[model samples]
Target: MSENNSSQDSRSRIARRVFPDGVDPDPRFTLANERTFLSWIRTALAFIGGGIAVEAFTSEIFGSGLRATLSIVLMVIGFILAAGAAVRWHRIESAMRRKTSLPLPLIIPIVSLASALGAGLLVLVFAGLL
Candidate 1:
């Protein structure tokens, strides 16, 4: 086999190993999974944008050190969310393929709590309390 074909075969083998039962899930469910993944990616991008906006627009208000720290925190959270989304997508897809119960979504609460904290910090900054 050509190198590319060999690579594809290896990947297929790995996927088959991961889902030994190898049942094809409903197309609608697969599509929904993909949509959810895309939404998470969009959310991650938004977080990154927010970080950039904070650094760009709030340096004077927050001071360079605090602004950069907040920006980094936002960006890191975005990165974590993006990675978690991929893992969640894989787990859900595998569970569906295996006719098993879906995995619990743990990222939602983390994101919610982080968002609340970030919002509170922003309020403090804007109110000159930080």
Candidate 2:
């Protein structure tokens, strides 16, 4: 086989191994799931970026300990978010392939609460309350 065909075959094999139980889903649903996954990845990156920015720019606004803690918290949250996104994507794809009702989006409320609290902390810090 050509190199491209070989690569494609490898991907297909891996995909089949990873998604062994499900039949091929509708193309549109699959694409939408991918988009949702990408958006979660983007949110993860944003959190990581916030961590980097905090560590780089907060020397004057925050004391050393608080600064490091906030940065670590943001980055750790980012990692968790990324991991959760992968698992969620897999679960969602499996549900669709199984033709079952969609799973409840358990991540939504958790992410919303985290984002709100994080933003609130930033607001307090900037307002000289922290």
All candidates' lDDT scores?
Answer: 0.87, 0.86
TM-score for each of the candidates? 0.84, 0.85
Best by lDDT: 1
Model 2 misplaced regions, further than 4 Å: 1-11
* Candidate 2 per-residue lDDT over residues 1-130, each given as its tens digit: 4666556553476786677665688999999999999999999999899999999998988999989989998998888889989989999999987888888887787688888988899899889898
Q: Which ten residues in a row have the lowest lDDT in candidate 2?
A: 1-10
- Can you give the lDDT of residue 40 in candidate 1? 96
